[model samples]
Target: MKKVPFIAVEGPIGVGKSSLAREIANYYQYRLLNEIVEENPFLGNFYKDIDGWSFQTEMFFLCNRYKQLEDIEKYHLNKNEPVVADYHIFKNQIFAERTLQSKQYEKYKQIYYILTANMPEPNLIIYLKAGLNTLLERISLRGRDIEKNIDPAYLLQLTKDYEQFMGKFINDHPNVPVLTFECDHIDFIKNKADLEAIFSKIDDQLFINN
Candidate 1:
């Protein structure tokens, strides 16, 4: 198969985006670009006290993702390697809108829109969907120390927001193919059959279109 130029997998917290991106990259020999949440100094603090550090954490992520996208664009165009990124730049805004106030969202939106205006969109976007209870279970199993106190209600709210936002985004960008998978009943990372099923869906979406 001639490689698709770019692909991205995105979902809410504990949805295994990085896992899927890495697995696909390894499988297809694409360059993997994963988000660096572990490297973000403000992440722990933000998780502990979102009101105080939400803007700081979001701004840091926004800038960091922009840089990654810029680097990916230049590198991929120059060297011609298919690219698989775990998250999209817009995902940060999905969180920011929920965490930030109206004024704060307005301010951030101005900058985000300007920066991403001409950015390259992925050839295919694979979106994972899971129920709130499933999301909480995954979060607990992952056991990130900072995430121990994460409110299930907050996650539920974010899940709703993600669904709405992704729904609208996909509607607006009709040319961008989105493969939405409900993850409430399956664990793609741990279940071999589940992983194969997801991969098969991806293969068909990416290859059959050609």
Candidate 2:
């Protein structure tokens, strides 16, 4: 198989997207780009009151991700190396739609579209989905203080929103493959079999499509 230049793994919080991205980046020696979750000042407050802090949190992520991608394009493109990232730029719109009110969402969408218009798209996007129970357990195990107050209902809504977002994303960009993995039963972190299975599927998808 011809080497893939870039891959992005995406999922709702606690779905293990970063962990899988790490495994893939390590295996392929690709540059790993994990999203910055703790750096946002509004994140903890957003968890407490989403509506109040959503815009600030979203804008922080938008600006940071834009800068990060710009730097990656410059440095990695020059070196001709591959990149494996935990989050895709599209998440900006997804989370914005969920967190922002109608007026805020419209404004946010305008800014988002502008920022991402010229950004490089990932060759393949691996979206991992898991049941709410699985998400809750994983979130608990990770034990982020800000995440401690996260409501189960909110996570359930996020799961549905992500599914909706992925569906539209695939429909709009048919050329880029979006491999959906249902990860309720498997522990990709601990089980080598599960990790291998995910990578094998990624390999098959890329090879078949390419």
| TM-score (all chains, Cα) for each model | 0.93, 0.95
- Whose lDDT is greatest here? 2
Q: Which runs in model 2 stand beyond 4 Å of their true positions?
A: 1-4, 206-210
How much is 85 displaced in model 1, in angstroms? Answer: 1.1
Model 1 poorest ten-residue lDDT run: 1-10
Clashing pairs in 1: none
Model 2 clash pairs are: none
Across 1-210, the per-residue lDDT of candidate 2 in tens digits comes to 464477999999999988899999988788999889988888999999998999999999999999888888888944677899999988888789889999989998888888888887788899999999999999999888989878789899999999998998999999888888888988888899988988898778767756
TM-score for candidate 1, please give it: 0.93
All predictions: root-mean-square deviation over Cα? 1.9, 1.7
CA deviation > 4 Å runs, candidate 1: 1-4
Worst 10 residues of 2 by lDDT: 201-210
For model 1 the local lDDT of residue 14 reads 85
lDDT of 1 at 87: 94
Superposition error at 132 for model 1 (Å)? 1.8
lDDT of 1 by residue, 54-171 (tens): 9999999999998888888887844777899999888988999999988998999999998888787788899988988888888888788878778788888898999999999999
